[model samples]
Target: MKSWSVVTDHREWHQGDLALPSDPRAWYQLGAVGGWQVVVADTPRTVAHDIVTARTTGRAGQTAAWCSLPFAVPVLCTLATGTGVAALQTAVKAASAEGLPLHRAVVALTVIGEGRLPPLVRAAATMLQSQVSAVVTVPFDPHIRAHGLAQAERLGRRTAETGASLATAVLSAAHRAWGDPLPPASVPAAVSAPAHAVV
Candidate 1:
């Protein structure tokens, strides 16, 4: 799988108009802003490894392939399958460890098979549950039947916004998880009070 940029444009709330080259690795062109472009070299590992790993283990991969992207920019994390929830989790963990804060990054996982979407979304929510700012899942597989290219185009378009949103939300959640002042909205609802609770 080779990487290439796909031509596009980014409109940020604060950064104003920006041009994204029609190349996949042009993600960095986003610079230190709230928007960008991400064209992933499709691969099965996205579904095979990331999803299975995250679901099985309580963590994900933090290798070079996953970490090379400019975390500072809103990232469009594309996969051949919508199964890289673990990668996303690993990213959050890495950000926390690096003291970078999750709210500063936006992450989107695109899966080719519509059937696999539900599980992927669930896994992401699981990762984000303990923090504020709900995780967003933009499903485009359903749009494949009518227009396959159209679906891909939509995926590219949504990546910009979702990337920005995820960045902000994750950063917020990361701070809350780490005991900062920011409240984490993504935290799962608490169940069963402590036994030591006063009667």
Candidate 2:
């Protein structure tokens, strides 16, 4: 069985953080508030940039948990644009059609600045909340102005490799933690028993 381990890149940050879940259930519970969820396509790669820069590898699952809440928050980690929004809408429709709980599905969009943010962030944010007082939307913190934005830089680069690695790591860890291996086998009913014991 594969276990989630950390990867590091020393040149990045002095703080070499290990990507572990402080609370996986918390992440999932918070995410469930949203109806359906997707992360920006390549989430691991996005975190990798920082890892590469920092010279460290984190347990892949921990990093993914940190990146976004997939079960609760459908992440759309893409460059903010008109096309991105359209793609997001399609994903939302599909998730909804597939019977994902949409009571409060929040579409999290990644953006570098005021320019690229999809015009629909405002529109999408309120979608669930307005319809069913139970729903709400959350935008990526655009105003969190960092002095030297290394974390922010990598946060936007979602790609297939990163996404797959991160997802595998998380699920692998979850399965291991939950003891999800094949069940035990049963004895044959035809086997004979001791006569004294039967009596």
Best by lDDT: 1
Compute each candidate's TM-score over C-alphas. 0.35, 0.31
Predicted structure with the largest TM-score when compared to the true one:
1
lDDT scores for all predictions? 0.46, 0.39
In model 1, which regions exceed 4 Å deviation? Answer: 1-73, 76-83, 116-121, 129-134, 142-199
Measured by TM-score, how close is model 2 to the native structure? Answer: 0.31
Give the Å shift of residue 198 in candidate 2: 28
Worst 10 residues of 2 by lDDT: 131-140
lDDT for 179 in candidate 1 is: 50
Off by over 4 Å in 2: 1-78, 115-121, 124-199
